[model samples]
Target chain A: MTDAPAPGRGWVAVVGLGPGDPRYLTPSAAAILAEAEDLIGYFPYVARVPERPGLVRHASDNRVEVERAAHALALAAAGRRVAVVSGGDPGVFAMAAALFEALEAGDPAWRRLTITVEPGITAMLAAAARVGAPLGGDFCAISLSDNLKPWEVVTARLEAVLRAGLVVALYNPISRARPWQLGAALRLAAEHRGSETPVVLARAVGRDDESVRVLPLAEAADAPADMATLVIIGAESTRLIPREGATPYVYTPRSVEAAR
Target chain B: MTDAPAPGRGWVAVVGLGPGDPRYLTPSAAAILAEAEDLIGYFPYVARVPERPGLVRHASDNRVEVERAAHALALAAAGRRVAVVSGGDPGVFAMAAALFEALEAGDPAWRRLTITVEPGITAMLAAAARVGAPLGGDFCAISLSDNLKPWEVVTARLEAVLRAGLVVALYNPISRARPWQLGAALRLAAEHRGSETPVVLARAVGRDDESVRVLPLAEAADAPADMATLVIIGAESTRLIPREGATPYVYTPRSVEAAR
Candidate 1:
């Protein structure tokens, strides 16, 4: 076994915790968490890691990603093993960007610390798996929350993706702060796709409260989605095939021959 | 522990092996593989798993995905626990779609058999993690090969994604059979994005041969990319930050204030 690193040689790992399911966590991520001397993230994500004697958890409120990233960078620069955890894959609208931002603007010495990103099962992947691979072909993931980008940007991207005839996955589709965004997105999608286009709403995927619903685009605006939900709008060739005595399976075929 | 199902109650699982690294495999995938009575996939992917007693391996040529999928489905229908393996996340231009296609056209009783898809770390996610988080914002994943779709469809989707100002990840960017596709795609992207926009090419990610190169979009066409490569064209907000003694880190900021 390798010994602990020498002082001033600390490293930081930005890890995805994988949608609230320990089983969904990759072995590489779990190993990194086990070796971490400090864990930093938003309160709910940080709390997911069990308490340990040598591990110091730095939990903060949401919307403070920059501050948390800076703290993790500082700890790593000082020779501590740090893990900055995010609920889904860190590179997908998570802490990975924040860490890179801090690294870019921080002191030059901060760049000396070793950093590695461990990919986890992102929410879209988990949700797709649950609903029978609705993202089986070309797809785009767009976050509907206007907290970071302007509403115009989101709308433009949504329209472009829809017109391109690619499956679309919407994250943060509806939040307490952005209640009407999902409806607006649905309306925008309806302009490009037919009313019969399939939409899958997967909430709290891989968790005890997990629920999945499949509906046509016409009725998708009424889906019970919130901050924890992922909305997948199917492509033109997407199919909802019914199974005997089981919920229908949704999938976008590999070939585009059936697409308009 | 749950007992194994009797004859005629077998199941099928489409599993992603995760971009060539066993460590990138999820525990759920590993567990499913351990219980698999038959393993079926393309030759290279099937060779990735070790041999064991009472386990049969079915390896086939690369382009016969439909035939291979049908074979796996037939095995599962015959009461065998079958696993269909793919290199990246099976849902993304992989075996998941093929399996679903086979299920859609096969015997109706085939739908009665259980099927589970275990998501593995997809190549784009692994590549994005390797080069920091260039996919931090909204992004689209498109397969550059035209084997399954018309060339016009790929070009149209590429242009749309570029115009939408979202990061674009191109899988199957180049192969010996299709060497001109990447250059054609680069030309199309150049028409939309600035010459200085960053492009990241990650080859054989999560393996010993892994290499990540970040360059301006103008020079992206010259980068060495093959079937194993994933090319990420950054959005307007993507930044490449240099370190004193190491390669620069590339990332797209979470906010879209800098996006065009």
Candidate 2:
């Protein structure tokens, strides 16, 4: 096992706290956070770490990921342990990439320090668990935000994934500024998926306000969703098993009929 | 915030132990496992859980997922708390689907028992963290094994995902009996991705034997790999950041220039 570098050895660990709940956080993440002298992340995420003496929090506004990452690396280069935190698995559309980008462009000395990226439960996986294993087989995760990539790329990725019959997880489904994007995505999914295909709208997954709904793609278009929502669009084989009292469990079986 | 059922209320929890590392296991998974009266899983996975005084371990051979699920469900129906373990996130190509399939097909009484699926770090995520974030942007995960699905489907998914310029994570990349599939997949990846595009082959991720390598698509085809290895083929935007003494970091830029 790769233990966290000994204290005073200056290392930067990009750790994922998992979706909102403390219980989803890995023991490794907790231990690494405890060892870090400084924690850096988007404001909401860094705030999740409880206050402790000798631990300084550098919470920044959204869209400053590169700056935050560079700051963390610089701290490590100066011989201070730092943890750059993210809400979900840092490698998936999160801080690890930003950290690496920053480290590549920043001071050469930073490369000498140890760096670790600890994986945690990402939203799609947590949301899938709360319901059932809709992502049991092949799947793709796409971020709908056009801030980084062109909006056309998002549309292309969705259509391709849909055509491939892979279950899809849509991250940042709505941009508060552009609510129509979710409707467009839901419509696109309907076109590529079967008429009776299921769609999952999960909001604030793993948190107290967690809500998960499985419905036909048509109805999902009108569902209320914010940036925090993680939307899962099922493949041709996805199914739901109704229960007497609870909402049905939805899962895609492992086996598939070979297409002729 | 769905809490595990009270001790007296029998329940079944399908949990992911996070790619063979104890540190990657979630606190929620650990707690549920601790509360379980019976632990059921494939031989290697069930053995991962220490022998507790009250917990009975039911370790079975592989390919018996359905039977194990039914066994767990039956025990829970009989008022016994049970934990069904998987090596990675149970929702991703693991026990959660089997459990739900069993619950749907088996005795109706299983529906009355409380059931929860606890998310854990899947191999791809853990493997991504081991290197830099090759999955930092849009990505798709496809299982190379045609045991459950048609081999043609695997080819179609790879081509589509590759054409869409999304990073790809290949699970069960090579079966012991069909080793040539890895070479074919690598060749297909080379066809779609740029020759210089980075590809990560991570084996036994998060375990003591963990080995991660990043190379061009052409070289990866001949690299020895097995079902236990998770192969990540980078998107066109994926890049490698050179470090003086360490292996270069690999990551996909969060942004993609619009395709004209």
* Best candidate according to DockQ: 2
Report the lDDT of model 2 for residue A33: 95
**A64-104 in candidate 1: lDDT tens per residue?**
98888999988888788999999989999899999999898
lDDT of 2 by residue, A1-260 (tens): 24334544799999999999999999999999999989999988999999998888999998899999999988887778999999989998889999988988888777777998998899999999988899988999999888898889999988899888899999988876777888898899988887778888899988888888888887999888897899999889999988776668889998878876
Query: Can you give the TM-score per candidate against the true fold?
Result: 0.96, 0.95
TM-score evaluated only on chain B, model 2: 0.94
Q: Write the per-residue lDDT of candidate 2 for residues B1-260, one digit (tens) a residue.
A: 23334434788999899999898888899999988889999988999998867788999997889999999998887778999999989998889999998988999777878999999999999888888899999998898888888889899988999999999998888876777888999899898877888999999987888888888987889888877899999988898987676667889889999886
Judge the docking of candidate 2 as incorrect, acceptable, medium or high. Answer: high
lDDT of model 1 at position A26: 85
Write the residue-wise lDDT of candidate 1 on B135-185 in tens digits.
Answer: 999999999989999998999899999999999999999999999999999
DockQ values per model: 0.74, 0.81
Worst 10 residues of 1 chain A by lDDT: A1-10
Score candidate 1 by TM-score against the native.
0.96
Rate residue A195 of model 2 by lDDT. Answer: 72
In model 2, pairs of residues that clash are none
Off by over 4 Å in 1: A1-7, A258-260, B1-6, B258-260
